[model samples]
Target: MRLTYQTDYALRTLLYLSCLPEGKLANIQEIATVYAISQNHLMKIVHKLGKLEYIETIRGHKGGLRLKKKPEEINIGALVRMTEEDFYIVECFHQQTNRCLLSPVCQLRGVFQEAMAAFFRVLDNYTLADLIQDREMYEQLFEQKLIEIS
Candidate 1:
């Protein structure tokens, strides 16, 4: 049930961007520093997010990153699906690679599927805006992190 770091960072990056004042942009270095993540790793996630049009990037000195879409438009479930490589919670989940002998009669596969569906069902109820209901709190926390880093 653990998400990959890619998904984790992507969400964090989006959260950070959402907390910014209107028209303000943030750089990868600042984001990486804020979360104590690697700049190199964050770069890849940023590139993916940019390609996905989740975040728009502006280059050069004053250039930075901002969300292309409003937080309300960013669905947590949709983002999770895009960021995750696969939903293979078990060996039987992958059709081609599944070698489990019990897969043919396994009720557990259906159970897992139901669990995954339930998981997404909950996530589908939320958006980036929903995650930041306490937007001011998140803003203050990020500000404190920035101060600590400095």
Candidate 2:
């Protein structure tokens, strides 16, 4: 199943933060600029992330955002689950909205369910830290963007 833009942005935001040096913070504008995303949209994702405790937002002029937990502690599967609104890959998957008369006998639904389970099973094995294993690479990429923006 494809993820929504919100989930995509949240993952990107986390990745950007993960690339920062310890104790350093990043602003929403900077992240938006770096990723070429809408600042307004990123703000909403940031708010949700903060509420979810994935990132911490500090107030004041000098304040910024940073990860509240270690990268290794942030499970990718868990984060996806939190950020995603629903897992209804198929119409029949959503009971309330489903209109398929074949749902009861549909083996396709079971296959999709198993596929989704396997997908999550793989994501469950990874953490934010795993995604940033090439920390230096990501750091250089982000730094390059900052340099260009400057």
Candidate 3:
């Protein structure tokens, strides 16, 4: 199952913080500029992340954001589950699926469930630390540092 844009951004933001030396601030605007995303949207994501205690925010001069916990402590599966609201693989898999006549007998539900389990299994193998290990390659792929406040 493909991730939503919001999950993608959240992961990217986490990965950015994960790569940092630790206890360093990463400005929201810098992340937005680096990712070519809207600052407004990034702010919302940051607020949610901070609320979850994944990251900490600081205001005023010489202030920005940083991770509250280490990268290894952040479970990818948990992260996705927290950030993603829908895990449906198909239209028939959605909550309001009265349209599917054979849903009761259809093996699609089991298949989808297996598919989702496998997906989480893969994600579970990698922590945010593992994701940002190849820092230069990651920076190159994203065309910017994960966190750049200064």
Candidate 4:
């Protein structure tokens, strides 16, 4: 199953911040430019993340955004869970679904549930730190540009 754009951006944003120097802040515009995403859309994800306390924002001069906690402190599974609202693998899994004829007999739900658990298990294995540890490689790939403060 593919994750939503919001989830994708959220992950990218988190990873970007995790890769930055400790206590350093990044602006939303810079993140958008680096990731090649729309500033408007990124803002929405950033707001949601800020609300979840995954990232914090500061306004005005010398202000930008930073991860609220260290990379190790963030859980990948939990982060995905926070960003992704709908995890239903099939129509039958939803609450408002029209009943499928095989709802009672089909083992598909259980199977899907197991698969979902496995997906989360894999994500849980990696923390934000794990994703950002290859700092030099990522810096080369994205060519991170630091903003100059006057």
Candidate 5:
């Protein structure tokens, strides 16, 4: 039930934006360096997030990325749903090409479904704000003191 690195990067990107001062912008390269991640991979995530309207991007000088919505407006569950295309917890969970012989009477499939639902249900309880509750902690972790965003 692990999220792909793409989704992981998206979440990290969003959290980083949310941590910034209001109206401040962060460059993709700066964020990549702070997180010790590849700028190329994060560029894709940033593009997808921009298309989803979760963040806004500016071009030219003084251009970067910023959170378009408030942290409380960003639902973790919905974000995961958009980033994660496949939710098939088991072979029986998928409708297409589910060759499970026990598909007709598989209690295991239902159990897995319930667990996955529960996973999202719990995630639904949280928003980006919840994850960034400890802004000071994240600030320390990122150590982004030099690249000041004015």
Candidate 6:
């Protein structure tokens, strides 16, 4: 199953923050501009990330966002679970609204469950730090130092 734009943005946001030199701060507009994403949408993501304690935020003049935890500390699987609203891969996966006739004898449910587990297993293998191991390449492409957190 494909991840929603929200999850993608959250990851992007984390990546952007992680790539910056330690203790650097980036404002919403700067990050949105860098990724060519909507500031409004990024604002929601930033807000949730703050509440989740994944990032720290400060308001007013000279205030911005920074990572609260190291990139390696951020678990991709856990992030997906937190950001993904639903894991119902199919109609049968949900008991309250499932109407599939094969619900009584479907092997697809087990398969989907296994597949999802595998998906998380793979994601758990990496972190934001792992994603930016090629930091020089990323920095060259982005054409800036971006942000840093201490």
Top-lDDT structure, candidate number:
2
State every prediction's TM-score relative to the real structure.
0.98, 0.97, 0.85, 0.90, 0.91, 0.92
Local accuracy of candidate 4 as per-residue lDDT tens digits, 1-150: 779999999999998887776767899988898888999999999999999999999998999999998889898989999999899878778968747888878898899999999999999998888888787777666564433311
Q: How accurate locally is residue 72 in candidate 6, as Cα lDDT from 0 to 100?
A: 92
Worst 10 residues of 5 by lDDT: 141-150
What RMSD value applies to candidate 1?
Answer: 0.7
lDDT value, candidate 3, whole model: 0.81
RMSD of 4: 3.1
Give the winner by TM-score: 2 or 5: 2
- Please, what are the lDDT tens digits per residue for candidate 3 over residues 9-39? 8998988776655456778887787788999
Q: Considering lDDT, which of the candidate structures 3 and 4 is the better prediction for this target?
A: 4
Using TM-score as the yardstick, the better of models 2 and 4 is 2
Q: What are the runs in model 1 whose C-alpha is more than 4 Å off?
A: none
TM-score of 2: 0.97
Give the range where candidate 4 is weakest over 10 consecutive residues by summed lDDT. Answer: 141-150
Which lDDT tens digits does candidate 5 get at residues 27-128?
999888877789999999999999999999999899999998899999999999999878886888778889989899879987888899999999999999
User: Candidate 1 — what's its lDDT?
Assistant: 0.96
- 34-137, model 1: which lDDT tens digit per residue? 99999999999999999998999999989999999999999999999999999998999999999999987989999999999999999999999999999999
Return the number of clashes found in candidate 3: 0
Which candidate model has the greater lDDT, 1 or 4? 1
